[model samples]
Target: MDVDLVVPGLYCLRPEFGQAYLWLDGRSATLVDTGIVGSGPAITALLTELDADLDRIVITHGHQDHAGSAAELRAATGAPVLAHAGDAAAIRGERPMPPPVLLDWERPLFDSIASNVPPNPPCPVDQEIAEGDVLDFGGGARVLSIPGHTDGSVAIHLPRSEVLFAGDTIANVDELMLGVFNVDRAKAIESFRRLAELGTEIACFGHGDPLIGDAGAKLRAAAAKITG
Candidate 1:
């Protein structure tokens, strides 16, 4: 596991699979997306080093990589877990995750990685969030319901800080591209475009390195090339 500073008060935690972001607000912190299972200890250590208390655990979606350690972390820190209502059941283990509608080219890649991802245990969500809801972190994070990656996928936009936490709607692997493995590709594309319209200076993604400057323009350029 590796932790890197993304901005003044934000840090990105990279584990073996997926990424988790830590946002510091005073002595309290908000964690966005918990890496795959067994990632809890490393994250807890980092928070301890910073002398920060866990304020909340926000799961971008119900995917295992994103919500895997949510239960463990919440249990350890006594922090509330938040997720979109659309995926609440899946996160709570009341239902199965909606399978992605993989494209022909995505088959091999998905098959290769799917087996490596550990199954996420059921986690309880203390808050069910939706579009337009302002979470009390990062100067009020506006929840933009950007579904399609999963029925409940969301992008958290901090208009005050001009930073956007794009869950899996977008990725920056080798470059800025639309995230793959979507249950609804068309809706994901639309959501991508909507996120591009936001005015942001920095964009943190669930994978790859984040765009630190002029992120809005980069997102727009990438969005312009994508078609449903």
Candidate 2:
């Protein structure tokens, strides 16, 4: 388990293969993403140690790596689960995501991670979010619907903090890169462009190290290359 406070009140938790984040505001917190199966306990313990209240679990999408432990975490902390309606079914385990259209290089990495992910059971979604929805937590995070990584993929932007929790819509794997294994490539690119326009100072990605300081410039450059 890799646990570190990326910002004053934002902590990143990496367990085995995927990442989850804990966002703190005063005494309350919101958990973004839930790593592979069996990660709830670790997250609960982390919040307890820090004396932060677990207010809710906000899933970026329905991918198992992101929503796998939502049920468990909700049970542990009594936090509601929020997700985009387009991905609610998958998050609830009603259906499987479409097969990803991978580049040659992406396949190996995908396989390596997928093979280790345990089967995820159905999880409940207490709220369905969409574009322009504002979660009034941690000084209010505005939801930007940056679909393409998945139909309902969303990023949470905190205007007060100038921080963007970019959930797999973009990554920083070598530099800023479009997330691999997207269900819709074109939508993914469009989402990237939308994110580039946000101009945030800090970006937290689902994979790779978080980029602090002028993260928007990096995203804009990447977006321009794709659009041009």
Candidate 3:
């Protein structure tokens, strides 16, 4: 329910398992992740608080919790959906993702929820992105590909502000759920090391509260455990 963590223009809506972010650049806002199916009202409330029209909705990955409301939100906002090509199939609900590597206990729970995510009605992708690609919002906000959480995972890195919207490639230290359920444990760790190199000051993850203060130290610590 902690919807607004305003930092100049970034606001966060706490969604279950994963969270969504609203980047207000001007009269329009760039929404990253639409949250789970039961998140429509909370998302709507975020828009109300921002007072900015959702210009475009960006899906960081294809998981249900990250993209559940995409089609519905698009209808309401008339905003285009942008995602990487790799996991587009999963997003469109054509094929469910492979189970997380090394985690057997959580498969049933994930499969159950993923089945209900509802295929996002195959919308033509307005833009297909790859790593290091820059997506502009008139001012300065770029969507950088970090991958690994899924083949198509991405992070919205506002270089000008040194803020990164780390989709699920990496979450906060407290995210026990993902600790037990990552599709590729090694790659996810690699992705985290990659983000660590970016020198991002504030990293807002999809599944937990944003990482604040000396993020480099925290990231390196996480990377060490993985490397070890």
Query: Using lDDT as the measure, which candidate wins?
Result: 1
Q: Give a tens-digit lDDT track for model 3, residues 1-228.
A: 567674777888876646888888776888888887667666766687667788888888877778878877877778888998877777666677665664567678667866665544444456777776777773566766665577788877777677878887776656412333566677777777877777677878776678776666677777676641
lDDT of 2 at 137: 84
For each candidate, C-alpha RMSD in Å? 0.6, 1.4, 2.9
Q: What is the lDDT of residue 157 in candidate 3?
A: 79
Model 1 segments more than 4 A misplaced: none
Query: lDDT tens digits, residues 56-144, model 2?
Result: 89999878788889989988889999999888888888887767888789899989878878877799899999888989786779988
Lowest summed lDDT window (length 10), candidate 1: 3-12
- Candidate 2 — which pairs collide? 148-188
User: How well does candidate 1 score on lDDT at residue 83?
Assistant: 96
Clash totals, every prediction: 0, 1, 0
* TM-score per candidate, chains pooled: 0.99, 0.95, 0.85
TM-score, cand. 1 vs. native: 0.99
Error of 2 at 213 (Å): 0.8
